[model samples]
Target: MSLTLAARTQHMTSSAIREILKLTERPGVLSLAGGLPSPDSFPLDALAQASERVWRTQGAQAMQYANSEGLMPLRDWIARRVSLPHWQVEPEQVLVTTGSQQGLDLLGKVLLDPGSEVLVEQPTYLGALQAFSAYEPAYRPWLADAQGPDPQALQPRNAMNESVRAAYLVPSFQNPTGHAIDADRRAAIAAALRAHRVTLIEDNPYGELWYDAPPPAPIAASAPHQTVYLGSLSKVLAPGLRIGYVVTPPDEAPGALALRARLLQAKQASDLHTPGFNQRLVLQLLADGFDLDAHVVSVRQRYKAQRDAMAQALTRHLPEGCIWQIPQGGMFFWVQGPDGFDAAASLPDAVEQGVAYVPGSAFYVDATLASRQQMRLSFVTLSVAQIHDAVVRLAEHLRREGRRSC
Candidate 1:
């Protein structure tokens, strides 16, 4: 007799970044491979103070099981934070998820059928793809330009073949490619979404980490009725907290109301709501005047310096044929190696030279020859001096491989 497993398990693969990270642990290797925020940015002392208050005053409720919708005060704060002058989010519409990653999984669970077509950016967030894969939805590549995915793709030319159930995108400082969707494009996409039958899943984890200015209002802001918005505290706050939320479309609409119930149900089935003590810890911090806006300002300033160091290092070190986009706001610099240079093929040699970066091929659903030429470098986790040194080492390795101009 033999045991069998679900067929969907075949689509699940180990994370490419985690596989590369193991190489960084070796002696003297510099990693620009992880999109981790500097630990220096966290307000540990303030958090300690908040934790003390939570334990002393609210320990019972904080440790007790909570409602699936989450703590009321936390939900109220999230609703107010996400609301704009034109659009208002109700507290009941906010579903506290373990992490934004869990929100993606819940959306996949509730909205996707085995064969449903879901539109996604050409090289989208790999985590979202992974979360959606377990449910077995068909992946369709989103056609995009410099600004973002073309608004025209929001509606298929002949959707009669199969309706596109939803489109997923990272509109602000997207992973693997640091391109942010501009205001004009957001409006165009919003207008297109208004005409289309598809729902929009807007996942924005890096919106608050902007270097120059805040990104345009979320695409959901333009068409709140049609978009299910997701946001996270990992970038601005500590990622270890694992706090994130989902803002469902207005409850007044019949479809949105139904979706909200299913989402809450999925969330309850997932973890019975995010850890109550953790939620209380964050609430205590906020109530104690944590000044989240000012905290983000400091984080932006620190990451900006690191971003500058990476930009300068790349210009001074990388071969003439190599190209990279200097991200204005996010943690990554998406670099394209010289013509015919395969980033994955060169990773072993680069690690041997004491440097590492994530190969870009894993980020694409429809990877091609062009995709193999790219890689993503994370500047946030390393110091400015380390970033410059890593770029120099990576360049030396590229030269040795005969992929760089002398």
Candidate 2:
């Protein structure tokens, strides 16, 4: 007899970016694919000191199994860091997860019912779509103009007969797109969510990594009762720690509590708890006067230089009609090619020429959008010199393919 798997498992596919990253491992290939922070920016000495302190001071506690709700001090720190005047979150309202990705999975399990309608950006975060898809939500595309996503798209419409149970937004330096919703749009989205009584999941892993001015206040600040704010230490501190927190609404409606409870249950099932040692280590670091703001300033300088390099490379190399926005923050640059060129179709050629990028279609909800001529390039991983050479090679490849004229 043949082995069988769940029906839901059948539709899932491997991440295209992961596959391309593998190809990029070939010696001499310049990869603009992975969303990786510079290794040089990590506070290795500080982390080592924190880890040592954790073992020496809290050794027993670090090794023991802890509560599913997470370490109290860590939760307290997160609550303090993320709180706003409009949304004063308490430690109890925070649920710690292995990473923000786990938060996404737990939210999907708790809130999404099969076939329920959820609104998402036209090209949303692929990882989010993957996390939510396991629960089988019917994704309704949220429309966007140059300014960013319009909140009206989530409104309950007589024409579509759809009521959005929830809408997910990155709001600040969104993945793949690297575009943030402006302040006005943030308020509009919050108002719409409140008016329609829809839940909002605000995932903000990259908010603190801004190179220029900070993005707008979170949508949660505007509609605290209706938003679930997810924050992470991955980009700012270290991803290996896998520490993230969720700030549920202040009202703590039955739905919100139920979702939190279910998510905690899911956490218990997944890992019994986020590792105790890591939590204590982070807490120790915070207590030790590790200035996150100053550290991030250094990080911002490195990334800003990279962003500038990528922008200049694109301007000098890319063919006419190709366009991209120079993001003020975040790690990605979303590029759109000429109308008839598909990034995926051109990937083999790009790789052969010693450069790699993620096809934009990987980030889209609809498979038809895969054919659209777009790509997401990461400015964080490659050196400035390599980015310039890669862009020249990529432009040459595109011209050879007749997709563009040099």
Candidate 3:
């Protein structure tokens, strides 16, 4: 017998980053591919205490099914934590998701139709591309300047007559680029979106992971009625909890409400709700004064040292013409190899030297063979000493490749 599948599945592909990660799982490779937080940074002991407290107090309530909107107190806490002095958010507008990733999938379900135009950065987040691809939207590459993505890219120009449904951006400490837009450019982008009446999905999981300084206010605060803001506990706390929240528009536009209803329906259809035990455990931690700010401060210090080590190692080992800019915050560094040097083609040689890194082409929605000269190296997972050795191995491989080119 033959089986049939939905047409939408045709465009879907396994995550390239994840596929590469599997290759790096060898015993001796020092992988700088995954954007994972250091295990040393997790508050495991505090979480254990919180779990014990939650089981004692909530007991059976923690095991039962929950409202699709998520735990009320958690929503309220998220609102309070993310809001600014000028920008206020109501708890009613918050929708807790399994993770910010699921939030992206739901947005794709409700906001996109086949052939809908969506604008994205030239080298955008791969996961977002994968999540939205199933909806079959036509993607327009947003132009970028030295600062970041250009706001003018969203305007209705005669060259591109298509109407954009939404533009997705990771403004702070972006995934592969590690570039943050300044406050002025953010305001410009908000104005452009408001002018075009286009919706903006601002994904900001790394905003709180800054090292030297705090990132600018969310663009959602600038244009509350036109933006959907996504936040997560993954970077600052732990990703295993899978707790993330979405702040919907204040006006609760028809589209916003409809989307929320559908998202809740989708959540119920998928998992019935995020694990209630984890929700209660998180709440208990917040209620018991877990000192999240203090925890973040400690994590920031550790990451700063790691970032410094990576910067120093890069200067010591990388071949001529290789370039990278040290990020003020965030986990990864975007590195450009010498002209015509393809990181993908050279991966075997790098691995033979006991080092591993992700080729940058994987991050683009419509990547090409010509884009293989760039790569992304994550500095958060490895210790300072290990990072030094990894860079040395990578440098040795690059030197060998450079001689072949010569």
Candidate 4:
């Protein structure tokens, strides 16, 4: 018998990065495609010890089902850690999710409706687009530049046109583009959101991965009442643990109570709760003085060197007129090839030459705005030597393709 599918299935699409990763798995292919954190950065020893302690000390309880809102201690830790001088987060507002990806899904479930207008950057995180698309919201491109999204777009066209349900941003070391919004621009964006009375979803998974310096205080700090903040330990701690949290608006904020309730209900429906053993393992690590801050510092230093290597290689090997910037932090570099280049079309040849990267067009919500010449190259996963080699292969592919274009 034939089976019927839900209408939402039409909006769902496979992740371009995940699909590319499968091809990059071929023998001898050096990937600059996936934004995978280096395995070397994981605190293996500390995690092993933490896992043992959880199994030894709290074996039964850790294995059982847990609170849907997350363990209180972990939530408390998140609340204190994310709290700023001007704005403080409360434990009640923190909802620990299986991963920040789950937080995105939960928010989309509660906040979006069919045809709801949602503002997204021209080239935002593809994963966010994937998560939110399931809820079937109409996407409007939030025009941006090197600085960040334009504040003027936040303004409503007329008083009656306040139909924009929410705006999503990755203010610190944004995925795909590696663009970080400066402090002044963040404040301006916050002001616009406040004035327009629009809700903001601020996803900040790479805030602590900064190489030069920590990114500016979160945009949520400036407009706490109008923003839903999502943070994750995957980048800083361990992704396998799948630990992440969402900070909802304060009680006094409009619709705060109802929004939080729906989010909690959505969480319950999704997975009942994140793994209790993982939560306990994190607490055990902290209690044992794992020194996460120090670990993150070391991670930053190692990634910075890798970033430098990628920068040097790109400069030396890429064709003239190809453009990219030295990112201050994060895993990937967004590079635009010279005129007459098509990054997506060149991927098969690049992979055949033993290198791979993600075409930047996958990140755009609107096909017309997507650039055919751009690709995202990840630097954190490969060693310095491998990075240089990968760039050489990629540059050779570009040159060979350019000869054909001429």
Best by TM-score: 4
User: Cα RMSD for candidate 1?
Assistant: 1.6
lDDT of 4 at 342: 96
User: Candidate 1 has what TM-score?
Assistant: 0.97
lDDT of each: 0.89, 0.86, 0.87, 0.94
Error of 4 at 14 (Å): 0.3
Model 3: CA > 4 A from native: 158-162, 252-254, 368-370
Model 2 Cα lDDT, one tens digit per residue, 201-249: 9999888878889998999888888899998888988889999888887
Taking all chains together, each candidate's TM-score versus the true structure is 0.97, 0.95, 0.97, 0.99
| Candidate 4 lDDT trough over 10 residues, lowest sum | 155-164
Candidate 4 Cα errors over 4 Å, as ranges: none
lDDT of 2 at 155: 78
| Better structure of 2 and 3 per TM-score | 3
Q: Encode model 3's per-residue lDDT on 23-52: one tens digit a residue.
A: 788899999888788888999999999999
User: In terms of TM-score, which candidate is stronger, 1 or 2?
Assistant: 1
Better of 2 and 3 by lDDT: 3
- lDDT for 8 (candidate 4): 97
lDDT for model 4, please. Answer: 0.94
